[model samples]
Target: MPTYISAVFNKDTRTVEFTADNGDKLIRSGGSLAWLLNNPGNLRPGGKYAKMIGQADTKSGKFAIFPTAEDGRAEKRALLRRKYNDMTLYNAMHTYAPESENDTAAYLAYVRKRSGATDQTVIKDMTDEQFNGMIAAMEQYEGFNAKPETRKERIVHATQVTLSDGARPMPATPVIVRSSNTGEKKVTTNEHGALPTFITRQPGEVIELFLEESGKIGSRIGQFALQQASASLVFARNMMTVGGNSQPHTPTQPSKEKRTPLRYVVQPGDTLASIASRFKTSVDDLVSNNHIRNRNRIYPGHVVWIYGKAPADAANDGAPATPTRSRQASYSVRSGDTLSRIADRHHTSVDALMAANPSISNANRINPGQKITLPVGVEAVPPSAAGSSRRAGNSGNPQTSDRPSLVKPPPETPAAAVRPPASVQARDTRSREGEGHPIAIIPFSQKRAPWVEHAYAQARKWAGKKEAEISRTINFHSELGYGKQFTTLAGSSNAWCASFVNWCLRTAGYAISSPHPYRARSFAADTTRFSQIDEPVFGAVALVGTSHVGFVYAMDRGRPVLLGGNQSDQINFVRFNPATLRYYVPKSYLPFAQKELKETKLDELAATDLNAALGIVVAKKAGDNTR
Candidate 1:
C-alpha cells in the first residue's frame, strides 16, 4: 500500500502519496503542525511520536539532519561525514538494507517542502543512516575504521515543474505554467499539494521565483547553484573474492602465551556467555574463535569453542601448559561480519577493533577468514561469568540448539551443500531483498517491568527528529526487522533491541560501538555506559537482557526499559531486563532485521547530560584498563 504525507507548511496542508518501501510503517502520521524544539535528531525512530519503524530500505544511502539553522557549510560537512561512514556500514553492519545508495539533505524541510533557511529556529528531521555515516567518517579520521561511513548526494531540484489548470492561486486553480531555459515550458501550482510557482534553476542556468504572494523573494534552495554531487565509491570485485578480504590485520597486544581449548557440541539451551565462563575465558575470545553470525541464535548440535582443553601432543607425551595466560584463541573473520559487528560479538568497543586491526579501514570491508588479530583487553561481565552456570553443569558451548537439530532435507537448507562450520562464520549473508529476507535474534529478557515505559519514552524522544522510525516500525510488524542481551541468551531469531538503543544514543551525539551479542543484560546511556556497560552506545540501539531494544530514556533499578517496534504484535513500550525476567519465543521463522537504511551518517544530536541531572558519571571508570 502507498503511504501519504499529509504534511502542512506555513498553514496549508496537502497529501502527497508516494510509494513506501516494504518495511516502512506509519507509526505516527504527521499532523498539520509540529513544533521545532530540542534536539530534533533525538526524536528519531524510537524517539518521537511521529515516526516510522525503520529506514527507507533503499539501494544504499545516507541521511543528515542539521539544525534548520545550520549554514550551508555545516550541512556539507555533515554530508561528508555520512559519506565516509557509508563506505563501511553499508557493507558491514546487519541492518535492514545494506550496500544500497542514498541521497542526503541537511534537514527534512529540504526534502519534504521547499523551505529555505536563514538562521531559522524551526525544527527539521534526519535519519539514523545519516547520523551513523557522519560519525563513522569522523571515527575514521580519528583512526577508528572498523565501521563504515554514510554516503549521500548533494541535494538537487530538477529544473522542471508540473502544469497547473491556471494561476489564479485559488484552491481549485492553484497551478501555473512557466518557461524554462531549454525554451520549454513547465508548470507549477500553488495548490494544496504544490509549491508556489517558482523557477529554481540548475547550476549554469537561470531561475526566477515569481511569487504569487508579495514580499517572497526567492533564490537557490541548495548548492545546485554551483556544486556537483558527491562521487560514489567504486569497486573492482566482490570484496570477499577480491584480494581486499585477506588483509593481514594484527592484534593490539603482542602474542600471548597459548590458552587451552574449550570445545562443546552445543547442548540444548546453552549460550555463548555460559560457555565462556565455563572455560574460564571471555566472551570476546569465544566470539573471535567461534565467529558466531548472531549471538542470540546458537543452535543445538552446533560446535562452539572456549578455552580450556590442551593442545595436541606433538610426541604423544607433551603436557599441556597452564591455560590462564592466553585462555582463548580464534578465527577473526566470519561470514556476514564487519569489524564493528565482530567487535560487538567480542563485547569490545569499535575502538578496540581499530586498535587490533589498524590496517583495516574504518570504512573498509573484511572477508571470511580474514585472519584478524584479537585483543585480550577488558574482561566481560555476563551474569554467568561468575560461575553459576558451571555449578549447574550447563556451561559447555555445544548445547542442543532447538532449531530442528536433525539436518534439514538436502533441498530444505540453503547452506547444507556448503557444510557450514559450527557457529564460527566467515561469509557475507546480507542481501538486498527485504521483508522476505531478514535476519533476527532471540528475544532476551530483562529483570524489571517498568523498563518498558522508560524504553517507550526514550524512543519517542529520538523519533521526533529522525525520519527512519516510521519505516522501522512498519518493517518489524511485517517480520522484516529484529535486539538486547537477555534476549540474546534467552533466545532470539535475530533480536536487535540493544542495537536499536545504541543507535538512539549515537543520533543524540554520543559516541559508542555495538555491544557484543553474547551479552545477557544492559542499562541506559550514562557516564556508566562507556564505563560500566561493556558495549556500544547509539540512540535507538538496544541493551541486551535489558527490556527489548527501543529507546532508553533513563535508568531505574540498574536496568533499562525500552520502547521498540515489533515485540509480539505492534510497536510500543515494554519493560525488559538483563537478568532473564521475560522472553518472546519466535513462533516461526519470518524474515527479520531486513531492510537497513542507506549508510553511516553524521549530524548527531546534543543529548541531555544524564550526569548533571542525576549526579552520576557516564563514562568508563577512571581506573579501568582501556585501550
Candidate 2:
C-alpha cells in the first residue's frame, strides 16, 4: 500500500510541493499534477505514480504519490472547508456572476452547469472538488486572487451631478474619487449625470470626492466610508434657480394668520399656567392653540399663542395698543429696567406691557429715558369676574377693575460694578496648533517647536548609519553618565529604539521621565500625557506595537516616513505601512526648549544627582506625592 500525503498548489511558481513523514521533499509541476489528476490508473511498480519525464528514485520506504482520484479528493475537501465558508462562497458567486439580461436566472444556470446538476442543486450538495473548481473559475473571471488584497479599492455605486442653477443635469462634470489607502481616480459624468463605476472597493474604507467645472480647480464635495454595496450621492451648489426660470428662487411668504398670531412672548420665570392666567385663559387653550409639543419646554423669548380675546386696542392691526389714562400708566425706563423687572414691579405680565408699548422693539434693550405704556390694574382678576371679564375681553372690551395694573413706580439708576484689569484675568495657555480647525486652515509652513526641530536635526545627523555607528554613538553618550541614567530607568540589554528617541528628545532640551524615556511600552502607556492623533505629524513619535518607536519625518504615499534606530540594524529613513502604526505621540506635549534646565548646569551634575533632580521634576509634573 502507498502512503498518501497532502500537497499545496503554489500559484506563483505553478508547482505542487509535498512533504513526507521522513522529511523528503516531493516536487511536481502543475501540468504533471493535472495529468495525474485526469489519469489515475498509471501507477509504477514501486506503488508510486511514475514521473512523466524523470527517473524514479527507489530509496527504502520512500513515499509515493497516490492517484488524486483515490486520495487527493479527500485532501481537497478538507482544504476547501478550512479556506472558505458557505457565505464567502455565495458572496463570491454573487459578485462575479456573469452579466446578463436576467442576472439571477443566469447565475443559477451558471452554478448548475458548473456543479453538473439540476437547477435546484444547492452549493452544499456539490462535491468539494466541484465547488473549488467553480470558485477558481469565478476568481479568474473577476481578475482577482482567492485572497483579498490588503490595500483598499474604491467602488462607485452612484453619482448625480446637477448644475448650479439646478435647471438641468451637469453633464460632463469632472469627478475625482480618492482613497487614502489606494490612491485616486477621475471620471466625468455622462449625459444623464450618472458616474461610471471606476473600481471595486472594500467596505469600511474612506473615500473623498471632488467636483470641478470650467477652468476652476475641484472643490471637495464630501468624504464618506464605503459602508454599503451601493452608494447614492448628489452634488449641487447652494444657490439654484426656481424651476427653469431665469430669476433666483425666493422662499414663499407665510399666510397672514400665521404671520400675525395673537401671541405672548414668554418672559423669564413664566410658565404655561402663568401665561394663561395673565391672558385670562386656560392652559389647555394655550396648548391647543399653539400646538405646543411640550408644555414645560416653553422658554423665555418663545412666543405662545393666546386663543381668547386680546385687549380692544390690541385688535388694531397687530400694533401695540395706545393706553388711555384710564386703562394705563407711563413708566420711565431706567438703567437695568428689564421687561421682566418692570413686569414684576408693576404686578403685571411682560406680555401686557408689550401689548401697550409696541414702539419698544426689543424688550431687553429699553433705554433709560424711553417711555413705555403699562396695562394698569389688569393682571388682578377676582374669582367671580374671571369668566365674564374674559368673555368681555374676548369681545374686544373689558372692565378696568377686572384685571391687574401693569403700571409701576419709575425705575432708579443702577450702580455699576468694578472689574479687574486685563492682566489679572485668567487665560488658557494650551497650544492650539492643528486643533479645532479644518485641516486646510493649518498652514503647511507653520512653525514647529524649537525642541522638535532640534530633535529632528539630531536624528538627521546620523541618518544612513548602521548599528555599529549607532552603538558607538550610544556608548559615547553613555560614558558621559547618560548610559548610567538610562540603565537606572530601563533594564540592561533591552531594545534601544525607544532609548534612542528619548535620548534625542533629552539632548534637544525636552525633559523625559523614567520608564517612558527608556522602555517603548512604558512610553506608549503614557497615552494620557500625549495627544493621540490619527494622522502622522512631522517630529511626532510613532509607536509600532509596544516595542518599536521612531520620529515621523513625513508622509510618503499615504504611509509614515520614519527616522529611527534599530530598524534593520541601522539608523535610516524608512517608509512604514500606516496599518502598522499603533499610536502617534504628539510633540506638543513636550516642554519648550527655553523651559528646560540650562545646559551648563546639566553638564556639571553627576549621574546620581541628575537622576534625583529628574525624579523630583517628574513627580511635580505628575502631581505625585513626593513624601
Candidate 3:
C-alpha cells in the first residue's frame, strides 16, 4: 500500500494522471475531480456543484493533487499513465465552476425557448371532443340541474377541464350542476375548488344567462376558454411522457441541501464498482449520474460525488470541506519535445495543449521552458505539500516572433506515447510461433488469444447495450493513417483489421477506456444486444487477405456468412478460413480505444474478393460465459 501527499499548482479540465508511491499512474479529470469530490453529489459545503456559470480570471485556471492508494491498489499504474496519453483531448483547458445568476438568466431563456413555453402559448384550438361534449351537456338537461355526483351518468365521460389559476377578478370558482328530476339542481365544487361550479338548466335558462353575461352570445368565447383549459390539461397530463429527461425543466444547480451522499477522490485503479461499494451506492447510480459508460475505468486525483449518499451519514464520514475551483493557463512551444511527450506528462494531448496555449505556433517547435502562457486553474493542495519531480525549471529563452510561440525543448521520442497499446500482447503472441511456414502461418485459436471462448461474455454484454432501433450488425471502415502518434491509445491493431472492429465498437457507446474490467470486440456493439441476428448486419467487417473483416449473416454450413472488404478488388464477403488466415473480431472497442484507432484511419485497405475462397465453421468453445 502506498500513501503520500502532494500539491497541484495548476490544472485544466483535462484528466490528471500522477505516479503513486508504487510508481503506478493514477488519473482523474481535472474538472470532474474538482467538481465531484468537493461535494460528492450533494448541496452541502463539500458537495454542491450545480452548474458551471462563468469563467473567472478569464483564464479559468485549474488545480491539482497528490495521488496515492494501495493499501492494495488497482491496475498497473502504467495503464493509468496509458489512459492519460490516450484520451487527453476529451477534456477542456478551462476548469468548470458554479455559474452566477447572470450566467443562468440567458440560459434559462434558452431553455424556455427550447421547451416552446417562453410566452406560455397554450395549444388551444378546441377539438371535436370538446364541441361534442358541450352539445351532449345541452341535450342532457331538459330543465333542472344536479351535481356531478348526483347525475354522474349525465357527464361521466366528459373530459375534465380546468380553469387557469391566474384568471382576473378572482372570484370563488363556480360549482358544477347537472339536470335533475326536480326544480332544485345539485351542485359540486368547481374545477378550481370553489362552489356553484357551473349552471345547469334548460336551453331557455342557458340562453338567458348567456345574454346576461354577454348581450349577444357567450358560447363562442366560453367555448374557446374551455378548449384552452382542456388543451392545457391534456398537455400537462402528457408531460410525463417526455423521454430522456433528468429533470422536469432544467436541473436546478445542485445544492448543499440536496447534495450527493458521499464524496470520493479517485484512487489509482479505482473502477466504478469499487468506488460505488465504498460509498454504499450502486455502480449504476454512479455511472448514470456521471455519464460514465465505461464501468471499469476511473482516474486518480479526481473527485466523485456519491449522489446516493445520505447527509448525516456523509457527515459522520467526516468528509473534507468544500474545495474551491479555478481555471488553467496553457503553454504552446516550438520543437524541442514533440507535443506527445509533453502532453503525456501533463496527462493531456498536443491538440489540447495547443488549444490551451492558442498563441503558440502549432508548427511544433519549442525551446526549453519558454513561457507559452497557459490557461489553467489552481489545483487544491494538501495541508502539507509533497516533493515534486519532472522535467521542470527552464526560464529565459529567445523568441523570434511576437505572435504566441511554443516553448521549444530538445526533441525526444516518447516511448509510452508512440508505443502501440497492445504491442506487448502482440509480441507475446508472435513469440509462440514455432517457425513461420510462409508469411506467419498460424491456426485459429492458437498463438495469442484465439478470440473464441474468452470473448463470449463481452460479446453477450455488448448485444444487450445496443438500442433496438439501430441495426444490430457491425460494420468496418479501414482507413489507415497516423496523425495520432506518440500517445498511448487503446483497442484495435497497429497495422490493420483489429483496429477497424475496435473503431466501430467505440462509436456505438459499448466501449469505454479502462485499464481493467473487460473488453471484447465481438460484443462491443451492445452489452445487452442479443437476438439471433438474421441478416449480415450493418457496420460488420468482411476481411479478404489471410486476414479480413466482415459482418455475419446467416450461418452457411455453420460458417458465419458475412459482408466485408477486400479479396482482390471491390468490397464484398468471401469466406473466413480459420485454417489458413487469422481474423480479428472485437467485443468492445471503448471510446478511448477507438479514439486511438481513429488516429490510424486508413483511406483504403485491401480490396474485398468475392470469388469463393475457403470458409470453415467453428463451434463455440466449452466454458464460455454466454451471458
Candidate 4:
C-alpha cells in the first residue's frame, strides 16, 4: 500500500513535500487550508474521528495532522462510513460541508456529478468506484487540487564560474549551460540551483554558457578547468574583486554600548499583561527577554528582566511610578530604622519585606526618607498621617503601632534601581544563551516548601473538565497568557498537562522562575527545584518518560494513580505502571515527606514493585506530557 511516511517544507522552493513509504512524492504549495494542514476532509481538532486515529496535533488544537495523503484520504473515508452511514448523498454532503462554512450546493453538485449518484443515493448503497470518486471530487472542490500560479524550473550548470575580486565564491547566477556537442541539449540545475560537478579535464571539450535571456556566450574549458581529471573544476578563488579584499585582512570590530535590562521582582497578583502595562512594553517583549515559555507561570518573588523603562521613569522624578497607588501606600524610613525593626513592627518577616523590595541593596543599612513597600495584607500609616496623629495625641511619635493602618500598600518593587544577586546575574547570562534550566524563585533548599497535597487538591478541583468547551479551555490556557491564542476550543494546540501542573503548583503557592515550565520534561529537567526519589509518594510529580506527567494521587495494586490534565481529554485519575514512573518532589519538601504522609494518613500507599509493568503508553495530545 502507498503510505505517506513523512512531510517536510522546502524553504528554497516554498513547498511542502509529502513523501510516501513507496518512495513516491507530491510537492504542494499555495493550496487550501486542508492541503496545508494535511487534513483532506478539513477535519477540525477535538473530533472523535481524528482523536481515535491519533492523527491530530492536539497541542495546536487546530486541524488534524495526517502524515500522508493516504492517511488523510483514509480518515475521510472512515468519516463517511461511520458518520454518513445511512444518510443519502445529498443529506450527508449538506451536514458534512455545511452551507454556513462552505459552498454546499456546489459541493453536492460536484460530488454527485463525479460519483454519478443522485440526491436519493444512500451513502451505504454507493459502489466502491462511486464512493472513491465522491471523496476525490469533494477534495478537489475543497481546493486541495489548487496549484501555484507558476513553477520555477530548476537549472543545471556544468561549470561554476567565478567572478573576480576573490575572498569567496559568489552565488551562482541564473545562467544556462549548453553542450557544444551535436546534441545541443540545455543543461539542468540541481535543486539548489547550482551546477553539478560535471566538467572533466579532457581537452577540446568546451561548454558554452550564457544568461537565460542572452544568446550564445562562449566559454573555454581550458580557461577554468585544471589538467588533472580528479580535480573536476578549480576556479581561482582570488578572481572576484568587486570590493573584495585581495590581501589577508581582518574586519574591524564595531564597539557597541551595552544596555542593561531592568530587573523587576514579581509580586502577587502580577500577570504578564499587567507587568507589561506598567513597564510600557508588550508581553511579547517580556517573554522574549526572559525566554519565558509560559508567561503565566511566573510567581511572586520571581525576577524578570525588562528592556524598557516605566512611563514614569522618563520624567526622572523620585515620585512613585504608579501615581494612582502612591497615596499613603509606602512607609518612609525614619532615623535609626533598620529593616529588621521595621519588619518586626509591621508583623511581617524580614525576608518577606526584602522580597517585596528588590531595590534595597543592604538589609542592615536603610537611609532615612527611603520608601519601603510593605508585604500584602500588612498596612502602615503614611508620613503625613503619622505627623497628624502625633500632633493630635502626643509629642512622642513611636514607629510601633498597636493598630496597623488600613491603607493598601503600593507595588512591592517600585520603579527604582535594582541590583540582582550575583547568582541571579549568572543565571541570567546562561538563560540568554539557552543553556540554563528554569530557576525556582523559592528554591527547594528554603524552609518554605511546596505541599504536594495542595497540588493534588488543585488538580481535583478541575476534575472532568474538558477542552471541548471554548470558555473553560480558554481559562486553562489563560493561566499561561495563551488565552488570546485560542479563538475557539479547537484552535489551541497547547498540550496543557504541563500548564496544569504549573498552574496547580503556582496556585498552591510555589513559584517557578525563568524559562517557563511549559513542557512536561520541565518538571524533571529542573533538578534544582525537584529531587528524584526511589518510589512513588502521594503528591509527588510522576514524570512518565518525559512526554507525560501527573501528580501521584494514590497507588492501587502497586500501580501509581496519576491525577493530571488532558488524560482521556479531561482532568482524571489514571493508573500507570510503577516501572515507567519517575517520581520527583520539591527538594526541600523531601524532609517533610514522612510528616506529610502521616498527617494525610497516606503512609500505607503501595510500595514500588519492579516486577509490575505496563506497556509504555505515552499519550500525544492536547499538549499533554509529550516529548
**Top-TM-score structure, candidate number:** 4
Q: How accurate is candidate 2 locally (lDDT)?
A: 0.39
**lDDT values for all models:** 0.28, 0.39, 0.26, 0.47
Q: How accurate is candidate 3 locally (lDDT)?
A: 0.26
Q: Write the per-residue lDDT of candidate 3 for residues 1-627, one digit (tens) a residue.
A: 322211122123333333222212233433333231221111111111112111111122221122322110121122222332232211100111124312434433442344333223221322345323322232222111223232211110001212211110111222222222222222221212112212122222221111012222221112211111101110000001111112223223422233224444453235788766644458888877655545664433234456553445332211223312223444443344444445422322234345445555532445665654331321121111111212221111100011111111212321111111121111111111222221221111111111211122122222222212111232222111111321112222322233334333332222211110112232221111111111222232333342344443223343444432221122223334434222222221111122323442211111121112111112222463111
TM-score of each: 0.19, 0.22, 0.18, 0.33
Better of 2 and 4 by lDDT: 4
The residue-by-residue lDDT of candidate 1 on 425-487, one tens digit each, is 322111221212322221121111212323333333333222233333322111111221122
- Rank the models by lDDT, top first: 4, 2, 1, 3
Error of 4 at 1 (Å): 17
User: What is the TM-score ranking, best to worst?
Assistant: 4, 2, 1, 3
For residue 448, model 2's alpha carbon misses the true position, in angstroms, by 1.2
Instruction: Give the Cα-based TM-score of candidate 4 against the true structure.
Output: 0.33
lDDT of 4 by residue, 262-296 (tens): 66655434689998876456899899866666776
Model 1 ranges off by over 4 Å: 1-262, 265-416, 422-497, 500-627
Candidate 3 lDDT score at position 243? 16
